[model samples]
Target chain A: MDEAAIDVRGLSKSFGGRTVVNSIDIRVPKGRIFGFLGPNGSGKTTTIRMLCGLLTPDGGEGTCLGMDFRTQAEKIKEKVGYMTQKFSFWEDLTIRENLEFVANVFCMNRVSERVEKALKGLGLESRADQLAGALSGGWKQRLALAACILHEPEILLLDEPTAGVDPKARREFWDELYRLSEAGLTVLVSTHYMDEAERCHEIVYIAYGDLMAKGSVEEVIAKTKLKTFRVGGKNAAKVREALEGNPAVATTALFGEDLHVSGTDGEALKRLIAPQASENGLSLDEVPTSLEDAFIYYMNRAKEN
Target chain B: MFSRQRIKGLIKKEFIQLKRDRPTLVMIVMIPVVQLLLFGYAVNTDPKYLPASVILRDDTFLTRSIVSALERSEYFRIAGAVFSDNAGDARLRSGKDMFVITFPDGFTADVVRGKAPSVLIEADASDPTSVSGALGALQGIAESVIAKELKGPLADLAAVRPPFSFTVQKKYNPEGFTRYNIVPGLIGMVLIFTGVMMTAMALTRERERGTMENLLSMPARPFEIMVGKICPFIFIGFFQSGVILFLARFLFGIPVLGSGGVLAAALLLFITCNLLLGYLISTAAKNQTQALQMSIFVLLPSLMLTGFMFPFYGMPEWAQYLGSCIPLTYFLRIVRAVMLKGAGFADVAPNFWSLTAFVAIITLITMKAYKKTLD
Candidate 1:
C-alpha cells in the first residue's frame, strides 16, 4: 500500500548482439528490503546499473525516487546511492581519506565531522587511518556501504554487496541493512544465498535474462504450487534414482542425508514416490516446499524453455 | 633433449596472444620503421641554406660580387635586402634571419684605397650549434670573394689579408654559449614529458582499479572531475618550471632578459596546453599501457621535430611544415625570443595566439571524446 520507490516497466538491454536483460519489470515499495535472486550472468548487475542511471536501458520508461529515469538522470542520481559489485573505492587511500574524498565530492558542509560520523557509525573508527586495500573482505564491504550512504539518499541499489563475505559478517551486514530500512531507506539488493533471500521482505528470481517469479518468501513458494516429499534411509540414493526421470516428478535433489522429490502436481508426485518408498524401505514424508525447492524448480523449468 | 614439443607449444601460444593484441603488434612493427625514417632523414645537425638579410648601403661592383660570392657558398640564402640597420635588427630579433650582412657607405672605395673596410656581420647566436657551422663558412667565403674579385689590376688586394675585416657580432648570445638555448628548450621538454605522461595515466589508473565506475555514479560532473584531476598537475608544472628557471639563472648563468611577466604567461599557456593534450590521450586509450605508449608517440615526434635537436629552418620544407604544427616548436621560439633576445609581449604574440588556439581545440576534442554514460 506504500508508494512505489522503483517502478519500471519493460526494461531491456543488449550487448554485442546478445540480449543480456530482456523485457523485465520491477517494483519495490518504499522502505522495503527487496532481494534480487539470480544465477551468474543473469543481468542482475546490469539491471541495477540501469536503475541507478549508470547505464541507459535500450527500451524502458520509468521513474526512480520520483524523478524521470530517462530525462532527469542527473536528478535521479542525486537521490540514489549505488554500491558496485566490486569494491570500487580508492584502495591506495586510507579509510578516512576515502570517506573525506566522497564527502568532498558530494560538496557536503562540515566534511571532517561527517567523515568522523560515518567512520564511527560503521565501527571503522579503529581502522580509520588504515589503507582500504589492507582491510579484509568484510571491512571493504562495510567501507563501501558506509561511502554510499554518506549522502543519506532515499534509495540504495546494492549489486551483490555480500558476495564473498563470511557468515558472521554477512549477518552483521544484513543487520545494518535492516537498521537502514527501519529508518525509511528503500533497499534493492541482489544476492545468491537462500537464507539472505528469506530475510528480505520480498524477492524476485531471474534466470537467463527473464524474470521467473516475484513475491514475498511464502508467496513465491505458494505460487510455485510445488509439492515436496522427503525420503530418508540408507537407500536414499536408490530412491532418488528411481524417482528422478518420472513423468510425474519435476525435480529430485539431495539435501544432506535426505532426497527431496518435488513436482508441481501434488497427487501425482505422492503416487509416484509411494511405490519407491515402499519397495526401497525408505521413509517418505510430505514436507513444506522451501524457497530453494522453488528456485531449483524455476531454474530447471527455465532451462527447458 | 630439452622437451622440443613443449617449447613448440609455448611458442605457438605466445604468437596467438601477440596476434590478438593488435596495439602491441602494431607498436612492435611500426616503432622501428618510424624511428628509422625520423632520425635518418628528418634530423640533420650540419644545417644548410640558412636565411640571411642584406643591408646594402653602397651598391658597388665589389659589394655585388661579395653578395654573389656569399650566396654561391650555399650556407646563406639572402631572403631580402633591408634599408636600415634597425630594420635588419628587428628581422634578426624576430628570428626571420640567422645572420645580417651590413655593408656601410663607402665600403667599396675604402677597400680599393688600401684602407681596411669593416663589414658588420651580426648573427643570432641563441642556438649556437645552428649558427656555428654557418659562421665557420663565413671566413672562407670572405677570403674566396677577395681572391676571385681582385683580378687583372686589383689582384694585390688578395695579398693584404683580403683588404677588409669582418666585425662579427654574435647578437643575443655574444659568447655563443650552448646552454643559453638548450636550457630554455629543456623546460618545454620536461613539462611535456612529465605533465602529459602523468595526466595520461590518471584516468586509466582509475578505470583499471574499478574506481571510475564509482566516481561516475556519484553526483560529480565530468568537468568537475577533469578539473580536479588536472589542477594538481598544473601546480607540479609551475613548480618544475620554477626550478629549471632558477637553475638556469644561477648555475648556467642564462639571463632572463625580457619581462618576467611575459615569460610566466607563456609558461602557463604552454603547460595548460600539454595537460589538455594528455587528457585527450587518456580518453582515446583503453588502459595504462596504451596511455603510456600514446604519450611516448607524442613525445618522440615533438622532440625530433620541434627545433630542439635541429635547426628549424635548416630542415626541408616538408619537415619545417610538420614542426610548425607541434606546440613545443612555438613554445621553444617563445622562450628563446624572450629569455635570450629580450623580446617583449608584442614580439611573441603569434606564438602565444597559436598556443591558445591549440588549447581550445584540444579541450573541445577531449570533452567530446569523454562520454558521460557507460555503454
Candidate 2:
C-alpha cells in the first residue's frame, strides 16, 4: 500500500493541567484531500501541530510518511508545507522578495528559478514587485500559499487558510489545493465553512478534544440517520422556536421562510409537527438530510453522551 | 555543496530583510554618530576651572604678593571673596567652594624677622577633580611666591635651604583627554547596546504577528534559521564599529594607543556576546513590547555598571563588585586597555575568556529555552 501521509492514535496534550487534545485517532491516506471540522478552540490546531511534528503529543504514537514522528520531526518538516491561519509572511517584503527569502530558508540550489516558478504558479508574477502589505486579502492569501509551497513538500497542513478570504479567493484557493492534490500532495486542511468541507474527499468532525465522526460524506450522513422536515410559509420563526425544545427534536434552524427541523426520532418528530403544520396553514414535507443536519445530530448526541 | 548553498542563501535573505527594515537601519547608524559628537565635545571632565576661596587674614606685603600670585594662576578662578575673619568652616560646610586658603595674620615685620610662617589651604575633597586641581595650584603659588621673597631675605644663608619646587604626575589617561578614555570604552558599549537592542525584538515581533508559526513549519532547522538571522547583524555591527572608530580617529583625534589587532579581537568578542544576548532576549520575551522593556532593563544597568559613565573605582564597594560581574564592564576595561594603553594578548586574555564563558552560558540557555510552540 502507498504510505499514509499522516497516521496517528491515542494522541493527548495538556496545557497547564487542562487537556486540550485528549487521546484521539487520526489518519489520512496518501494524496487524499482531508478536512478537519471543528468549532473554535477545538483541538484541531493542536492535532495539526502534532502531525507536522511541530509539537510532541504527551501520549501517542504516530508516523508521518512512514517516518517515526519523535525522531523524524526535522524530516517531516522538510516534507510538509504548513500554511498558518494568520497572515504570517514579512509585510515589509515584496511578493518577489518574500518568495526569494523563503527559497533561501529552504536553501534551494537554483533559488532564482524556484522563486520565478513559485511566483508564476501562484499567478503572482504580475504583482511580484508589489509590497506584500499592499496586496489585498485575496492576493496576500495567495502569496502566503506561494511561500509555503515554494520548496514543494509532499504534504500541506493548512490551518484555516481561508478564514477571512472572500468567496472568489476562497474558490481559487480550493482550486489550487485540488490541483496540488492531483499532483500527489496530501492536503490536510482545517476549515469551518461547510462548502469547503464538502470539497474534501473525507471529513473528520471533532468537538471538545474528541473526534466525533470520520468517513466519506455519504457514509457520515448515513451513520447520522437524521430524518429532517421542512416547514415553511410565514411564522417559520415561531415554528422553529416551538420545535426547538421538544425531546424528539435533535436540532432546529430557520432557513429564511422555512424551518429545517431534524431528529433521529422520525416518528415522534412527524407526530409533533403534523398537527401544527395543518392548524397554522403551513406546508410540511419530508426533505433529505444534509451534512448540516447530520453534523447537528452528531453534535447534539455527542453533548448527551 | 549543501553547506555553501545554505550559507550563501541565508546571507542573501538576511541582507534583503535588512534592506527592507528602514527604522532599524536609521537607528543603528544615527545613535552612534550623534553619541560620539555629543559626548566627545560636551562632556569635558578633564579638571580645569577650579573654584578657590581665599582668606586674606594677613595684610603684609608678602601676603599681598601671595594673593596676587594666586589670582594670576588661571587654574584657580576666585569663586569666594577675600573674607577677613576666618569664615572657612561655614564655606566648606555649605559646599559652595572647593578650597579656602588662610594666610597667617602678621604685619611685614614677622617675615622681615625671618619667622617663615605658613599658610593653611582647605580644599573640598568630595570631588576628586576639584581637590586634585586645588592642591596642585596651592603648591605652585606657595613655592614660587615664598622663593621670590626668601631670595631677598635669605640669599646669603644656605644653611636652611629647603626644596623650593614640587613635581606632579598624572596617572591613567595622563593628558586627561575624554576621547582617549571614552571612545575606546564606547567602542565596547555601543556595539553591545545597539547590537542586542536592535536584534532583541526581531523574532518576537514575527511571533506576535503570527509569522513564527509559519516559519517553524518550514523545512529549515532552528539552527539554520538562527544563523541566518544573526550573521547579517554581525556584519552590520562590524561595519558600524569600523565607521565609528574611523570617525573618532579622523574627527575627534582619539588615539588608539593599543594594538589595532587586539582592539579588533575585543570588538569581535563583544559583538558575539551581544548577538547571543539579543537571541536570548528574543527567545525569552513573549511580545515586542516586553522585548523592548527587557532591552532597556538589560542595557541601562549594562551601560551604567560597565563604568562607561563613571570610573569603576568611584562606585561604592557593592557597585564595584556588581560591575566586575557584568561582561560589558570587563569588555569595556579590555577595550580601553588595548586602545588607550596599547595592551596585548596577555592583557586581554582573561577578559576574552570571561566574555566567552558568558556567551557560552547564555547561548546554551537560549537554545534550551526556545521551543517551537505558541505556548
Best by TM-score: 1
**lDDT of candidate 1 over B228-312, digit per residue (tens):** 8888898999999999999999999888898899999998999988998898888788899999988988888888898887778
Superposed model 2: Cα runs more than 4 Å off: B1-166
Q: TM-scores for all candidates?
A: 0.94, 0.76
List fnat per candidate, in order. 0.86, 0.77
Instruction: Fill in the DockQ of model 2.
Output: 0.44
Candidate 2 local lDDT, A96-141, one digit each (tens) = 9999988887778899998988887888788889899998888888
lDDT by residue for model 2 (B17-110), tens: 9897665576577657645643453233344445567776667666777767777865555776667534654444333354576765673455
Give every collision pair in model 1: none
lDDT of 1 by residue, A1-305 (tens): 77999999999999998988999999999999999998889899999989877888999888887788888888887788999999999999999999999988888899999999999998989989999999999999999999999988899999999989999999999999999999999999998889999999999999878999999999988989999999988778888877767787877888877898889999988888888888888899999988888888888887787
lDDT of every predicted structure (CA atoms): 0.89, 0.75
Question: Candidate 1: where is the Cα deviation over 4 Å?
Answer: B60-73, B111-116, B143-166
Per candidate, the number of residue pairs that clash is 0, 1
Q: What is the iRMSD of the candidate numbered 1?
A: 0.9
